[model samples]
Every structure is written in structure tokens, then in C-alpha cells.
Target: MEHTQDNGSVVYPDVKTDYHGHPNYFRVLIYLLVLLGLSLAVFEFNLPANVAIAIVFAVAVWKIGMVIRNFMHLRYEPILIWIAVFAAVFILLAFFWGVFPDVSMVHRELAPKL
Candidate 1:
């Protein structure tokens, strides 16, 4: 048996649903805007190359996490779903690492002449 809320989300019997009353979309938008502004500022600032790149990358990761958690609603998902998502990322990183050396040698003397 299930009961439906006004928001249309069904409440199942014995199932744990930690509904946080739905996130505020406007607040998430504001957060995204701030993160975007910070990322853009990294390009405008005269910081050192390594520092600027690191900051921009960090901002990008932060933005991705925020989007995933809030926009994609991943924060409300079960632990298994999170594990699957992380596993996919791990596979992608493994693939990238496996191919990275060959890609880096593309313009070097070790590269085969075609």
C-alpha cells in the first residue's frame, strides 16, 4: 500500500524516504551563479598559472557536485545508486589513464610515422 503526497511523490510502506521537503530551486540557482562567477573570476585575476588553474578546476568540481546533488537529485538517492555513479566515474578515469600515455606521445619522437 502507498500514499501519495501533494507533491505527487508516493510514500511506500516500510521504505525509508528522507524527503527534505524538496529543495529551493531559486537557492540552487543562486549557488550556481556564484560558482560561475567565481570560475569566471579565475580567468580575470592575475594569479599564478598553477594557482589559477587549480582554483578553476576546484570551482568546476564544486559546481559539478552541486549540480549533481541538487539539480540531478542525487542527494536523495540510495547508497547503491551513489556507488554505481562513482563506479562509472572510476571506470571513466581508468580508461582515461590507460589512454593518456598514448595520447601524450602523439607528437613525440616515440610516435609512429603515418
Candidate 2:
């Protein structure tokens, strides 16, 4: 519980601002930078284009998880929030998966040039 002093000043609980003065945050930033570097460095290996794209996507998903858990403060959130986020992602993927076949499979040309 917070209380007001005789001088009419309130003492508040822990407050987070801008992530300044936080060593862990700086570490996370460094880690993210490293991930970014690695993702960029993927191009140097001369891997197949599809393999490179897969690696980039895997790295991207990991980076997104890290950013959400650390930077967005979602790690401290409740389980329900994680469920909601996953549910939303699942629905989005479902929609895209459902549309992919139709979009990518076409045997006919709609109209020829005049």
C-alpha cells in the first residue's frame, strides 16, 4: 500500500520507464542485434534459396518470441494472454493456408492479350 507523506507526496510502488538503467534490457538488445546479424549473415553461406528462406523464417520466429517475451513485457503476463496470442496466430495461419492452394494453383489464363 502507498501512503501520502505529511508533505503531500505519494510514494509509489515499482515503476518501469523506458527500460533505462536496466542491464538486462541492454543485454536483450545486444542479443537481438546478434540475431539480426546472424539473419543477415545467412546470405553468405550460399545455401539453396528455399533453405535460406526457411532459416530466415525460423530465426524471425525466434526473434519475435524473444521481443515479445522480453521487450513487450509479455513474459510476466498471464497464461490467457499467451493463449489469445496463439489463437490469433492460428486463425491467421488457417486463413492463409486455406487460400494458398487456390492462389498458387491455376491451370487457365483468364484472358489473352488483344
Candidate 3:
């Protein structure tokens, strides 16, 4: 809801904004703490390297989302902004995909037996 002032400027009353307004800081802090704790737990288990990497990557993705939503105020943004962000992510993934096979193949074929 908005109210119009005598100067013809509009003021939003009930709408909550994140960046320039009050943010849900407590929730964000809780998420950060939880993710941090989980990351620190990575050394406790004797899981295989691949599984450990996957777990850490999952947590990292979640933490990134939380930071984007709360810290960057991306949750309140429009759909086009989301599309743009996703496009950037896709481009990054494509770059990594292009680089992965060469690295992996070289590592697999050229590794010296220990």
C-alpha cells in the first residue's frame, strides 16, 4: 500500500524492502552459522573424497542462495533479474564444462603410481 503526499510523491507503508530497508538478519545469521558448522564437520567423517566434495558443494550452493537472497536482496527483485543471474551461472558452468574434460583426462592418464 502506498500513500500520496501533497508533493505528489508516493510512500510505501506496508511493503517491506530488504536492501534499503529492514532485513531478516536473524534468519540469515542462523543460516550462515548452520552452514559454517556443517563445513567444519567435513573433517569428522571418513567419507570418500568424492562424497565429501559433494556434501561441501551442496552446502556451498545453499549458502550462496542464502547470501543472494538476504544479503544481496535478490529475493525481492523481478523475474528478469533472476533470468540474468541464471544466465550468468549457465555461462560459468559452460566454461567449467569446457575446461573439465581436458583436466580430468590429463590427470587420469598422466598420473604416476605412488
Candidate 4:
């Protein structure tokens, strides 16, 4: 009896093509620059609190999208998958909004009593 490996290809094959190519140094440098700029904006800027928070969140979302599309290989996924991803994001935002008011009211009420 002989054991078979996954992919069912022979244990040793000659002249196999590499699935992954070499990294592009230029593209990686550009990504690094963008990340550094975003980091600087978050930590060094003297913007209003809400504005800073919004900027950070926006940059984070952009970075996440980049990673999902490139690193996760989701760029070619179906539209349904994109819709599901966006729907989950909206649901999370709604959940936070629903809880924020109650939390704010509780803090306000408790602050006055204390």
C-alpha cells in the first residue's frame, strides 16, 4: 500500500512553477509611507478630538480594505461577499449607537448624584 499526499501530485515533480511571485519593493515602500503618514496624523496632529477620531477611523478602514483585498485575496470574491462584509460593519455601528445613548445617560445621571 502507498500513501497519497494532498493535491494528489507525485511526491517529487520536476519543473514546478512557483505560485507566488517575488515581492514588489516599490509597492511595499509606498504602503509603508502611507502607513507612516497615517500614524503621524493620529499621534502628532493637534486637531479637534472628534475630527482626529474620524480621521483615524477612516484611515483604519482604508487600511483594512487594502489588506482584505490584497493580502486576504478577497479582491476577486463575489459581490455577495462584499455585501455581507459591509452589512456586518453597518450592524456593528448600529449596535454601538444603540448602546451609546444609554451609557451617556447613565454617566450623566450618576455624575450628578455623586
**Each candidate: RMSD to true structure?**
5.5, 8.0, 7.2, 9.4
* Model 1: per-residue Cα lDDT at residue 33: 95
Candidate 4 regions exceeding 4 Å error are 1-29, 111-114
Q: lDDT tens digits, residues 1-114, model 2? A: 353534566665454533212226777888889999989999899999999999999989999988888778777567998899999999999999998887678545743445
Q: Supply the global lDDT for candidate 4.
A: 0.65
Output the TM-score of candidate 1: 0.72
Where model 3 places Cα greater than 4 Å from the true spot, the runs are: 1-23, 106-114
Native-to-model Cα distance after best TM-score fit, residue 12 in candidate 4, in Å: 24
Question: Clash totals for all models, in order?
Answer: 0, 0, 0, 0
Top TM-score: which candidate number?
Answer: 2
> Among these predicted structures, which one has the highest lDDT?
1
The lDDT for every candidate, in the order shown, is 0.82, 0.77, 0.79, 0.65
lDDT score, candidate 1 = 0.82
Task: List the candidate 2 regions with Cα displacement exceeding 4 Å.
Answer: 1-23, 108-114
Q: Who is ahead in lDDT, 2 or 3?
A: 3
Residue pairs with backbone overlap in model 1: none
Per-prediction TM-score, please? 0.72, 0.72, 0.70, 0.57
Return the TM-score for candidate 2, rounded to 2 decimals. 0.72
lDDT minimum window of 10 residues, candidate 1: 13-22
Q: State the lDDT of candidate 4 residue by residue for 41-60, as single tens digits.
A: 68577888888888888777
Cα displacement (angstroms), candidate 1, residue 49, comes to 1.7
